[model samples]
Target: MLITIIILAISAIFFVSGKIRSDLVALCALVALLLCHILTPEEALSGFSSSVVIMMIGLFVVGGAIFQTGLAKIISSRILKLAGKSETRLFLLVILATAAIGAFVSNTGTVALMLPIVVSLAMSAGMNPSRLLMPLAFASSMGGMMTLIGTPPNLVIQDTLTAAGYEPLSFFSFLPVGLVCLLVGIIVLMPLSKLFLSGRKKREDDAKSGKSLKQLVNEYGLSHNLFRLLVTETSKLAGSTVIELDIRRKYGLNILEIRRGDLSRHRFLKTIAQKLASPDAVLQANDILYVTGDFNRVKEFADEYAVSILDGHATEETNRNENSLDFYDIGIAEIVLMPTSLLINRTVKEIGFRDKYNVNVLGIRRQRDYLLRDLGDKRVHSGDVLLVQGTWNNIARLGRDGTDWVVLGQPLAEAAKVTLDYKAPVAAAIMLLMIVMMVFDFIPVAPVTSVMIAGILMVLTGCFRNVEAAYKTINWESVVLIAAMLPMSLALEKTGASASISNALVSGLGSYGAFALLAGIYFTTSLLTMFISNTATAVLLAPIALHSAEQLGINPVPFLFAVAVGASMCFASPFSTPPNALVMPAGQYTFMDYVKVGLPLQIIMGIVMVFVLPLLFPF
Candidate 1:
């Protein structure tokens, strides 16, 4: 018992700290259990080939199809359009959509599909996206409570109860409690979002710089009449600097900035050439000059010398309306995609993307946790966020598409891809049908099978373009982690580890009777979930909960429900679930943000489920 406790504790630490990759941690625990004679090698490795694991893989492929087809994107955009411009209404709509989908689809999928739209909506509303994204993540988690197939925890609980000789929970058994929890969560969360989330501040920095320079100009904007010129070797002003040419006095114009290269409209050649030849070096063949505040001065300067006035790419019609048009230089910034982003496992080559939309993917920021070869060519995976770059206009465009990628923050130029056509209603209908099947037991197909079928049908119907594209839609790392952890869960069960520890627990808490025991079960499951994957914790504890019930001579139904609710309510840590991890980068959240919000929510839910579950199920 002591040895088992120690092993489980070590595994728990590894899971909770999230210091190592989850799959690796699970692998190590399985090996250790086997080496210690806790389980045979075959037993240790059995989880990899489990039906659950296979189901997950197929479902992932299907999810990828739905994502690639742009179905989710279409649904999100229409929702936003219907939301009007009200912040309250917009947030509510997002929460509703996210929760509704999350209740039936994968929780990670819920966050991945919704985050881009949330960021876009926040930008359109002139609000900081950081504030909204996290709440959206939290809301996705809350929605996962509604059905058995909503999350792995509920599934674990149902299977555990059935194995323990009790009636498995019906799909909507927890609907009332789940609805109450979801409502309470929204009410508690909305007001705190701004406090925890901040806006993209660099945009303001770019604007400030522009405004400072603009204010110094007498014309307050670029004067079209003044032609900016570059001094070449043939020009009379080629040998002149600011001091030598006395440009301000001679032409009644001040130099705004200097650059080299193309003179295209709005494309500033800010990178000046290096390697000055001499202290008194005459301006070379490519010295750009930005003269401001005077039109005739440009003509006079050009006439006096052989300098070439720069012709902008903007046409004459565009220049005519230039006064009213707000032409801010779209800035470039690097953003890291969070691990929970749906974009993981996808590549630009597959997304039908190119740089025409003003968004450019300059580069990627690969995590040190896992080594990725050929950054651009390598497929994106969970825990591998990206550093993308793009203009605000392009970022907005990408966000509105349903290609299943999340914008981490500001786009790095390399990661921005062209937006594609999305069919929202079709995607929503498919997703809705899958959820309905899971909840109402309508089709009787396995939850994972339903997801896979819907996903394939979406692709066949031209909802998405390619078969491989659909493969990129699932969170493979989470799937792998769940698979690997199953071995550890089995080890825990077979080692007599769970029964020993649970017996001690039951004896220690027997004084409080079944109610206190139920609370302990819920609290333990919830707390463990915050550290380990909820499914792992659920599987490990099911035997223990069942064992405890046998000793207490009461129905295990309430006790089992406690495990399900507890395991699913894992919002307090990033590693607890993918939704938490997904929002971290986009929301710019710290560990404390989750603790501040999730801890209390977990505590309240723990209490509620313990007291209320017994009443609902009867002890």
Candidate 2:
């Protein structure tokens, strides 16, 4: 027991300090437990296969697909429209909308989905995003209180009950408690957020250094040089690969993308496919190619290949207005050459960008001067910002060669924002089906099974761009943290450490009746959550809460609920929850910002839940 307590104490200290990664800290603690012989190998390793962990993983994929397909954004944006320039109204709606979505999505996913939208809306309303961002983070936690799958702590409690031979909670078992949490959060957070978060100056760097796509296009005069060419029936370009044509080398023309239409089984309907122009992409009749080059060179190339120039006067105004260029499959980014770059004096052709980097140098920004055409003979200079275009994956590779050049702005974040809106309907239908399967007991599928089915369906139905994209949605850090920490609970139980802690609690607070004991459990859990992750805290304390309730001759349901609520309601620190930390930088929030706005909310919530749980569960 002493060894177990010492290991847990060291782990808690590291968790609070935040120097080491929490997941790493948990793994070290697991190793200590094994080395101490407090747990067998099977007992220590069981957490990896825990149903709770599996459910969380599946939920991550489901939430990722929902966001990737733009369903969550559409719903939130439409609902936010009702706020209509009223900051107060916007505040209320932010809380309500976040809570509603969070009940279905993980709180981290909920905040991530809503962050950019809320920032955009807050700025449009002429209010600082900070006014709503903190509340947005808090409301996600409150929202998680609404359903069994809403938060990890709720699952921890449910798992505890089932392991103790008690009835497991239903899907909506937390709805009433969740509703209460949402209401309290709304009432308390509105004034607190306004008082503590309003009128903060935006960070100067908040305006990203990278130019927007439209700005880049206009500055480089790309629209004036870009043209569309059609591959007609008699066109020599048909049935030939781009490599066979070697247009870049022979005609100074770059094929940016290819647009093709194919007739579906429903012959009247045509599905349009847009793909990045690769060297091996074979051209066929009726294919429309987006090409960029000098007007005369493009005309000469089209005439030689028997292709028709579809748009003879494709002016900058028309291209900008129509938004002809998209970054779905391919993307563009500007990279500044390092002072010591080996290619500093090399011409574009000499550098062989196409052969080496698989990207095309479309333009160069040398201070105020822009060179859009005749880029092949242009010499690369130090500190020159070259606008390169290629597949998003290839563009990402440029950042890895940091010694040569630095890619500006957040290319990956920009890529993530490109929504697959066409798949929204499919994602919504899959989400609805999963909810139905879980909500209705008449359905034979388990909740975890329903989530797994929904996750796989999301990938199969193309909600995400690819399977790899789907995998990126899961936060492996949080998953591993939970998995590694779960075994600590088993160690505590095996060594009688959990029973001893519960006995101390029962003896200390039992004389004051169950209400005081309830407060003790709630406050202890909440306090611990402020330091470590809420999921880890719940894993450690749940068994103690259960043992305490049993020793007091009371139903463990209320105690378990208290544990869940306390473990989740932590708000006094930004590090307490992922959502809180997520908004800190964007909202320009300081540590005190969270303490001033969140501490009172935390205290009031604990007090309320302490009284409310017993009434609802009838201990």
Candidate 3:
């Protein structure tokens, strides 16, 4: 018992410090107990096969299927359109849509797709992005509180209760408290959010003034190296087309543009300078060639052919060709580092950021300042904003490698547009039917079986683009954390530590009545979740809360409710949840932003759940 208590205390310190990864901490605690012979091998490995863990894995697919079919994008767009330029309405719509959608899908997925849309809405509505972003994140968490599969924490508590020989909470068991929290959060956050929100600068002003071509050339040292030449009648290249010459490879110069006179324009009439020049344009007398490369190469071409460098002029037209758009297949993107990103503290050079992701790091935004140079050597930190240039295909591929990266702003024009997937309604139907079957228990099978069937149906119906993609959506963090932490819970029980802890709790607060004890459990869980993964918090605390109930000779249901509600209340800190991290970069939000807005809601939720759970469950 002393050993169990010592191990748990050490683990708590690690969780509270937030320096070490929770999964690593949990695994270490499990290993300590294993070497000490506190648990048999089967007991140590039991959580890997926990029903809750299996169902959470299955739910990832059901949720991914809904979003993969592009159902949320289509629906959320309509809701925003209905909002019709009202900032208040758009605010409500963002929260409502994110909340509603998040309840059914992974909040990270919901937030990833919604971040750009909400930013665009805020920009158009003439409101600061921060005013709506934090609430959008908070609402997503509240929405997850509503459904059985909303968040992994909910399942952890439910399964923990079942393992204690109690009837598990139903699919809709969380609805009442979750609905109250959602409505109250929307009401309170919408106005209070404005008081704390601030932007680094106006987005519109920054977009308009971003960087000019001449400025880029000066900074990149390209001046005097680019030249335009005119093709004369005596030129060997006259009458030959660019594609015919293969001038790019043969001459070692990238042709920027070709200007022709009105009389000679017929030779190259179909060209558009804004887009890349077509190789089919036939060279003609009086046609001007714009190219950039080593001066020696340009001079050689000029001397060999009947051409003269159009000297003493490098105007705005040339300046306009200075950006990455000048090169084919190059695209720029902004991505925010996740709070739990593995890239944190790792230098871009160390990670081979350029080669691995095929992106050139251009700038870094940390806090309110933007760092434009030496970014490759700067060690990345959580919430560090990165400006990168790469091919659009490379950017999309990078976004998929992990949850650590979230693609910012718009998808590239080169990216496949999110067309209305005709399979959306079918996907929605499959999801709803799965939920109904589980809630009603009408399938003559266990609830987990129904969930598995739902996941399988998603693939068979083509809800997800493919089976491989669906598997990628499963949150391996939650799986590993749960599997690692459950052994600690088992160690607590097998060594009588659970009873000892419960007796201590009862000795300290039993006289205050079940209300006070419930409140204590709720507040402790709530505070822990603000610093740790909510799933881990739930996995560790739910069993203790149930033991407390047993010691009090009352029903374990209300105590379980307290732990569930507390674990889901991750509003007090941005690091508390994934959705919160998603919006931090776009909104330029800081830690205090969450505290100023989320504290009151956290208090309100604590008060209501403590008083209300007993009435519903008769503790």
Q: Estimate each model's TM-score.
A: 0.54, 0.69, 0.49
Query: Can you write out model 3's per-residue Cα lDDT over 1-619, one digit (the tens) per residue?
Result: 7987788778767755667765678789888888888988898898788765677677667656666666656565676679886767878888888888777655654565465456656655667778887887788788888888877888888898878777867778888877877887877786688666744455553342334433443444334456778788788888887778766566666565565534333422222222223455678787777666677777887888768877534643455432212322344456789898887999977866655665666567788776654554689888987766555667667777748878665434323222215567776677677656654534586657777888898788656545776797676765666666666656765776654554565457756878888888888778767644677668777877887778889988888878878888778765566566556555765556667788887888788778888887786
**Ranking of all predicted structures according to lDDT, beginning with the best and ending with the worst:** 2, 3, 1
Point out the worst 10-residue segment of candidate 2 by lDDT. Answer: 263-272
Best by TM-score: 2
Full candidate order by TM-score, most accurate first: 2, 1, 3
- The deviation in Å at residue 165 for candidate 2 is 16
Stretch of 10 with least lDDT, candidate 1: 268-277
- Model 1 RMSD, rounded to 1 decimal: 16.8
Candidate 3: regions farther than 4 A off: 1-77, 198-275, 278-507
Clashing pairs in 2: none
Q: For model 3, state the Cα shift of residue 243 in Å.
A: 9.1
Off by over 4 Å in 1: 1-70, 81-89, 101-141, 147-173, 191-194, 197-416, 422-444, 454-480, 530-560, 574-597, 611-619
For residues 540-607, what per-residue lDDT tens digits would candidate 1 score against the true structure?
Answer: 77777777877889888778777877887777765576677666655656556677667776786676
The CA lDDT of each predicted structure is 0.60, 0.81, 0.68
Q: Which scores higher on TM-score, 1 or 2?
A: 2
lDDT of 2 by residue, 516-536 (tens): 988988887887676556887
